[model samples]
Target: MNTKFEELEIKLETKQAISDLGLIDLTPIQALAIPKMIDGLDFIAEAQTGTGKTFAFAIPIIEKIKLVKETQSLVLCPTRELAIQVYNEFLKLVKYQKDILVAPIVGGESYERQFTALKKKPHIIIGTPGRIIDHLNRGTIDFSKLTQLTFDEADEMLKMGFKEDLEAILQNAPKERQTTLFSATIPQEIKRIAKEYQNNSSIIKAESETLTATKIIQNYYVVKKEDKMKLLERLLDISNMDSNIIFANTKREVDEITEFLREKKFNANSLHGDMKQKERSYVTSNFRNKQLNILVATDVAARGLDIKNVGLVINYDYPQEDEIYVHRIGRTGRAGSEGLAYTLLTPRTEHKIKQLEKFTKTTINKLEIPSEKIITKALENKLIISLKKEVVANTNTYDKIINEFEQEGISKDALLNALLDKLVPSKKVYEVIEEPKQKKSNLSDFDNKKKDRKDSNRKPSKLKDNAVLVKVNLGRKDKITPLIILDMFGSIYNIRNNNIGDIKHYQTYTVVELSSKGHSFINNKTFKYKGKNIKIEEV
Candidate 1:
């Protein structure tokens, strides 16, 4: 879909590697960074995690790695998990070249094995800051012949308090080598490193100049911390999610949530950094294959492991940092797919939500907790859709079968009722907190209708002038009078009491209008009319 990659003088092997990995195209980050990297330029790339920045550098790094080599490249990552993941990614991308080897040296592994691996004289070294520096000091790893040095998740490394170690690692590397820094943010420390280490470098900013997970509808559910588990259960039952991951702030919470879900008849597994290698692999594989519908994880454990087709990500507890929240939500809505990220927030977390909104540049819509009635309505909607799709779509065949039943003397009402019963499954009501509705105070009943008639008689004056009529499913029965509508948006949407164009209310639905603008505003949201759930959309 993008033609920019074609303009660059890229190696056939590199292009083939991308295609072999089924990455036929480039993400915005890749498109910007790859051309610069191919030019052998030192660069700093600012991006979020899960934005394909990994491959942006890996593709060029692979292209430059000589088949016959001696540790020509060194990649420093924040965590051992990320280091291992980068190494594996390099392995997958460079499948065309059999001579290249990526050795990941990190903690929690026997130093003897890493020492022996270093002895093999690998072409590339991928490691965390502390372990990489340990090897550098012991002379177990060689970087004297290194041509390129990259710091993956530079911001993360600094956040993890690895600045001094990162500096030491960089100091040991050759000054003549090219350096590439990749981070979700460009902080002062990152700039300091770039200034000291890099030459006339290019700056690739993917975050400010790219579309990211546009399909995802992000929302947060504000709940009391004590009621989070009960709310999570209700959410699971209400949302028709096929698969999901629940992230907790601690390993204890991960295990606790996993146990709670399992007890509640959900197939859930917990993964934390404390797990053994085999256990981690088993949990991840089971989750990926849908053998488990839920995975409870800590951020540290789920780092850098790619899982596909996740429909939802629940932030059971909010992350301490805004960057961590970005990474947590990034787990879902990956590879250009729609996902839902629901954060369970307490009253104290209002500031955190504000910060998140500012940092992510996306509004987190607040959703009312699912009540028994709301869940029932949602289920009915699903049933109606399924019946229309599965039963109505096959009406001809069903008609023939029903005719055969009629020959056996089955009554029409009996048959119809039976079909309806079969199509609509029974659901149990659940407990949920109720939100109070605000009542309108100013406009009188007669004045409301008169105001609507006055606006309706007025002429259109705005751009693309056209009068569009929209309807909302709320009425007098739901306590949504014309006065209520006028009061709700009085000054917030620049709507005035006299701007209301019409007023019509049936037992179940209401039709209202405004001078072009107010109609569009109300039609775009899901809101409450009195205590009832009201959905508004274009006709």
Candidate 2:
């Protein structure tokens, strides 16, 4: 039997909010934690990411909050991204209550803005430990009126060396407050925190054995690192996915991948720490409103975000942490809906797959990279489906055109083929390359060579006849170093260190010699870094 949110004894407003968010059924974590939290009991929940953990606590906080002129609930997260994400989720839950106010306190933004928000006497406070502690030290925030507190991603916080900050906040907070700690994994530090702070806390464990929802179809493809983007593009072309989030390891990779996707005519954006708050919000809003179909983001930038209807999650680069792998794939297969997660792996990272399987307690099946023929067939099938829909909607209109063509001495079969050709243009699909049998080493040698090149004052005129002088629109003024430019080009074009040529830097632009082939590959393509389009042209 399935449990619904309505069955819980929450306020009608909260119930309405849940319905507004289109949440009909309660997830396992929510089902187990909401009641205990509403009863004002302390809790220590072991729930994985994307398990609707935010709502497990947010709904109860909204139901029990008194809407006083002071902070009644305080939620602490590990990073500013997660803090803002939690604040946004709380806002959704309190949409029906006009009197309720929430504020997010995190580092990286102006302190004056936080001070102004604190002066408003928000009913709830959401922030990271460091920023929250900063507010406490300045005597700008008071927790005397706090009735409930939550440590979201508690294990991550401790791992980030926030034990003293957490202890300071807990010491100042009222002991009678309802405390809750939620973590994906309960390390010894988390256990210690729970033992010391929580009073008779109801320990609820949503184990990793069921961490990944059964609805998610997980698969991985083994390919060379250089061929990752090519494989990714092929998958995107053939998968018929409506919405996707591609995870990369660094901000540079996120920007480069997003730029590549946009060049391919994909409605894509990037989210990373380097982006300002406004830009991040804009990208997120566009994604939510369907203005953007793909969002390339780093793990930290995407934490605690709950975007709806994400049909696919692609790990373009394997994550360093096993837990992060879970969170990356967890973005899909949400809200009882079916989703697909694909990971691109190389021989060097193939062993991580087994570790991931053990950590997630779910089998990640091996999948062969799709061939050009397979992709072409998939594209044809999609076009046929679309043509069928069009005919079903306006059969009479198409029938008239078909009759005219038939009367003009055109056979029905020929007319149909022409229409199909027009609907789905014929294009050359790249074939999947087989992985080499040789053992591949890490990129330390490439990194060392890049570092050496960056430190050298090389001139562009010394390049070979095959090299072309290319100008890029970013320079030292924009904090664009030589290595950054190299990384951008290398990531987008999958070029090696030797393929690059001489380089020169300027105040507002840089000129570099690229192999004629490399120059042609990106000749008319749009490339972006830090959300700014890089205008490239051969000099």
Whose TM-score is greatest here? 2
Colliding residue pairs in candidate 2 = none
TM-score per candidate: 0.69, 0.72
Tens-place lDDT per residue, model 1, 1-539, is 67444455666765676676666567788888887877789999987787788888887887787877588888888777788788888888777777788888987678999989999889888888888888878888888888889989898786656767988988888888989999887876688788888998667887542433666678888776668888888888777677888999778899989888888888889999679867987898888888888989987788776677788889998875677777877777766678788998765453357657877778889888888777777878877887779765674556787788899999778898997887664776555554433344465545443443443332222223454555566654566666666665573465775556555554455556655655547445776645557565554
Poorest stretch of ten by lDDT in candidate 2: 454-463
Residue 21 in model 2: shift from native, Å? Answer: 4.4
Which of the numbered candidates is closest to the native, going by highest lDDT? Answer: 2
**RMSD of model 2, in Å?**
14.6
TM-score (C-alpha, index-matched) for candidate 2: 0.72
